[model samples]
Target: MMRKTLIIALGTGLAVTPVAARERQITPYIEVAQVLTADLTNDDVLTYTTLAAGIDANVQTRRVQVQASYRYERRIGYDDRLADADIHSGLARAAVRVAAPLTIEGGALATRTRSDIRGAAPGVLQGNVANISQLYAIYAGPTFGSHIGPVGVSGGYRFGYTKVQAPSIVSPITGERRDVFDDSRSQQAQASLNLKSGTVLPVGITLSGAWVRDDASQLAQVYEGKYGRLDVLYPVLPTLALTAGVGYENIEISRRDALFDAAGQAVVNAQGRFQIDPNGQRRIDYNFDGLYYDAGVVWRPNQRTQLEVHAGERYGSFSAVGSFTYQASKTVAVRVSGYDGIQTFGRQLQTSLTEIPTAFNPGTNQLGQNFNGCVFGAQGGAAGNCLNSALQSVSTSAFRSRGVDAVISVTRGRTNFGLGAGYANRRYLASNAGPGIIIEGLEDESYYLQGYINHQLDTRTSIDANVFANYFLSGFGPQVGVYNIGATTTLNRRFGRFNAFGSVGIYNFGQDQQRSITSIQALLGGRYSF
Candidate 1:
């Protein structure tokens, strides 16, 4: 399958000629909006006004690429119950070719999500500081690739840091409050040697290895992984090829034990989590070491279309992976990708930042911030997998996740349309040896679908609408699940360099028969781009 990490994608960058007539813009704009929100489930009402200024930039040159969307909002509430808030959300990534064979790449992401699965919805999440949390992640790395005769040598090293600001959240299932993800530091190093076909006995050969580490502050936990793989490629036809690989991996996760009192009860800290003892005995959470293998097929009949499918044995089990991509100019795009790997809350957010399109028309919610877990692309609307599953719940445990995402988008005439769907299931890994024993054998699953439409009524007027539904099933029981649904539309008109828009949206959340929260919100705003 087509797999590329920051180490591979940044260092071994794809070479493309700079577009002569690209749509590049660096627009700085300020917006002031009056908002009204009413609770549908309850009888509460809120009136507020937000003052925000942000920048949306997309710039690409022969050797540099960058895209960013950021907003800072200060909300003034008319009622004391409707508290004021400061909200921030943004995503940015950049790559630069420092030399002919050296590349530097980095990205930063900030998002707001629910502290618990039972929190307020993303759209109507205003004034709910207890249930809302903000997360930040940043990573930078350099990759070096050079050719020594017929052999290709590539290597890279990366460092990442992630932090989350969470408030006190109480669980309804057990009425227990605990700490979620606080912070973590990640590091990765990789190197590879490649020999092209016909230069190495008519068969392509590649030997690659990597080492990864993550240090988390929750329980003073640590994750270490080492893997090496040798791959072979043989062409059976001009457009078809067979590929196989065998690898050995050693992965381990460990954490310190909690301090226990005289009665054999774990001592609780101020955050409701167990008190971690620095000098206590450390215990293994998960350990795996074995050989893995996979065989796959690659098909490419044209420049705009390619398909790759593979089946393999990995993580001590059987697995399947594949990718299909089609892009025709800036009008049409189709993509389907699959993944099966170990993931953490921080790593998942970091990886999602790498998938954002460098050139895109940023989409925003009623409050002028991008919706949770979704990113717009150059293909009309959202043209890539949504990151909803990655930001859903703030579970700090490492887990094995398997998922698939597909998007088909097209722009024709003065209308743009797109459809996207994604599914993910994560089985958490925690041993019964320490404080982690509380969350052993847990699982979480999710599926989501989203659709968007944009039509021009005139040269200066347009209407944009989108609808989304996301369902999550927790591991607490077979029938325990939460549903998130929302729809929003905006009517916009442009006059010179100034634009005016109004939007309305409704958000609904249902968790089994225990509780439900529903709200409707509206906004009227204008922005001046400079």
Candidate 2:
């Protein structure tokens, strides 16, 4: 089941309308701005004027939804560091109920971003430097489910493809630029059956299983896994339920060269050379098989509050999951969630897609909803907001991560405010001794905090402000920790369909025990929307 939120019109004042009754809308806008920027570290100042044109369009109905944004900017001034480019960022998701028991859904996204601004482990990339990158991803699947005399059955197959384009890096040996990229194709199939006993019995039973495979071309990595679980639930009360479950999972990795000799002897490849097997295939590095069980409680005292908590043992390790959401009032809401899981990087993306339904906001693009601070601070350009670093690719390391996130938002007559914080820690399962290893695997932790406020000063004027900070730590790495802090403020005035805005921002980025780089930017622009 998926949850849907009502979309609210932003910037433009409009009443919320049901998707089924609303017509498609498209707005074309253009902005001419003068931008002045300075970097404190190099004491360099650059001034430029830019002309940008973009379009925003959205269509929503009972069976389909689409949203997209595209902008092209041309810079005219004396600045060797700036480049004129086209920026495309958007997400489109659609689901069609083909029949009573069948539904098909799919989504696609394209993004232009920078590596360093994305929160990847410091040693994950070759030079560990932030550079521009582009990502294109798409997934589609069909689900079939229906009630058959109190027994519900459903199954689906999802196929996904991801392509990443990263900036070229200079080769150490040749001193020439070379393209390094990551691309993967993956597929997942899952099925589940559940039986609910009405007044005749107090218990319900559910059985589910899933299989996944991923092939990453550039990294020469392949992963496959199988998982199964059986759950039993009892309704202790109308608002409370008890649950118990048992699960088993098996994971396998292929195309990985071993670090030892063939005779089971100790052989350390100091230079990180690859050793091929007799079958002309890379040796396996890691495998896992485990059985786990857990007990939990789901409590929903009322419509405004709900909480779920569970704990158990898996693979001889402790595991847990929990979440709480409270609609404190008509104007306030809060959510807290935490989870610990062992999964491959590809599977992580799949799981995130499942969670999107709960967080989806039609008013904003998919990236904005997922990486709020980045989209908010990088309103004018991608380079200004590196907060997307948290969503970086970690396919190089199969790992277990535990993380928690909390957010609260409030809305008043003319004001809106929000605050959020998150933390995550990851431990790699595979050893970092093989060839193509940029840096040894290490425990990595990251933290994020952001706050934002928007206020409508008058019928034709508004103001927006936001501040954010991010910190990352990794053990046994040259770049042990890196931190970033930034703040931005904007004021806008509207005259009919034309608007004028001014924004200023300050940012600081620093590596562990190193001198930080500080930058300041200001922009004044006018836009017309029609």
Candidate 3:
């Protein structure tokens, strides 16, 4: 599949290169990329490296454009003793202007991955396949202005299908089959309206909504969601402008004919942000939503000095942070910030695995149906009755969380660097389900820190590097700690009248108590103008 995509992209580029000579309208572009890396953690004997490469091409004329991309990555581990990882993905997009006020675009994307453990201990082989396909959308709106101003609308409907497969493993004790096979089909539609102000306001406001219908046998369902936003730009003064807006979003998921309940239906998202800017000298922004809110201000006292303040809230907890930045010279700048917050806890439950007994069948997947088959079992000697009891328990109280964040930055020449550190403490008690279920035990705290930097040679060339590390004292379930690092670079240039650009980044994710992930990515391509 990767080879075929690359071949088609190369062919299209060659076909569109001579459009200038033929006096025909055409645009062509291509990009290629590669990456290599290794892990240097506490282990010195086990080394892993990844390689990724890809190509992208685009061809467009006055009324139409076509784009395609393909990427492949492979991981070698244990001193090149094992082929540990692989990933392949592809994308295609095409758009055309059907009329003066209407245009259409569509695309398809797919990816697959596989993993194996050779030098490791045992039982570490894993693999999965993911595929999605969708059709294009055509949009139409008025070409002229409305009586009040310009009014326009754009929308599209998409039909998508997906299929996934995973390996089956036998329970260490029950010796039952535990592989997974899932297939899903879904359709989604979205539309939005933009009203330009010839009226009281000079800014435009847009309202949008979307709906998705997904089917997976007995798990088939429909989700409906909508949102609206009003935007306006007000000139507070010649040097300062203020932007204020608010929006409301809601989504409800319903099963076959049933009204969506809190457990089954998700609430719509409610969020908005407001901001004020005085050119580059000072800026203030307020951001908030249903669960969180923050207000930030930046003041530039001079060309070389800056001060900032940030405050926010999460539920019952509140936080505040302050920072200062100073340019020591034309080539160097430094900054520091401090933050703190408080947290509390209610009740939470730990998630664990249980074995299904011969009398009951647990079915499969998230939407899998349950039927009489085998009874279930748990770890150690605490199987059967003990496992069943735990599953039936519920909690009434909630957990409390509190945290603080601090940061600092430094920059020189074409390079800039940053450091961030934070801490979170949580308390969990017990809760009653009102009826019968009750939960118990869960108290923990965690701390984390990360740092990164970027270097840019010029507009067409730059590099970024970042690293993240996290740790937790103790938690109810799997460890929520990991280390991540990534680097990306882009190259852009022009040959005659044509222009091209491409970028590639590689990310490394150290395994956590839950799962481990590692991925290599690359993209490169260019375009020509006629």
| TM-scores of the models, in the order given | 0.91, 0.78, 0.37
- Residue-by-residue lDDT tens digits, candidate 1, 103-218: 88787877777655545445454455345677788888888889999999988887889887755545544444434678899887888888987786677888888888889887
Worst 10 residues of 3 by lDDT: 343-352
Candidate 2 lDDT (Cα, whole model)?
A: 0.57
TM-score for predicted model 2 compared with the true structure: 0.78
lDDT of 2 at 86: 43
Best by lDDT: 1
Cα lDDT tens digits, model 2, 26-99, are: 88888788878777788877777767777766655544444445555566766446554444455444455678
User: Model 1: which ten-residue window has the lowest total lDDT?
Assistant: 8-17
Clashes of each: 0, 7, 39
TM-score leaderboard ranking: 1, 2, 3
Candidate 1's C-alpha lDDT?
0.73
Residue lDDT tens for model 3, 259-347: 23347431111110011112212211111223333444445556666565545554335655554545455333343434332111100
List candidate 2 segments past 4 Å from native: 1-23, 49-51, 70-77, 83-86, 99-101, 112-129, 168-181, 197-200, 256-280, 328-332, 357-395, 433-441
Which is the winner by TM-score between candidate 1 and candidate 2? Answer: 1
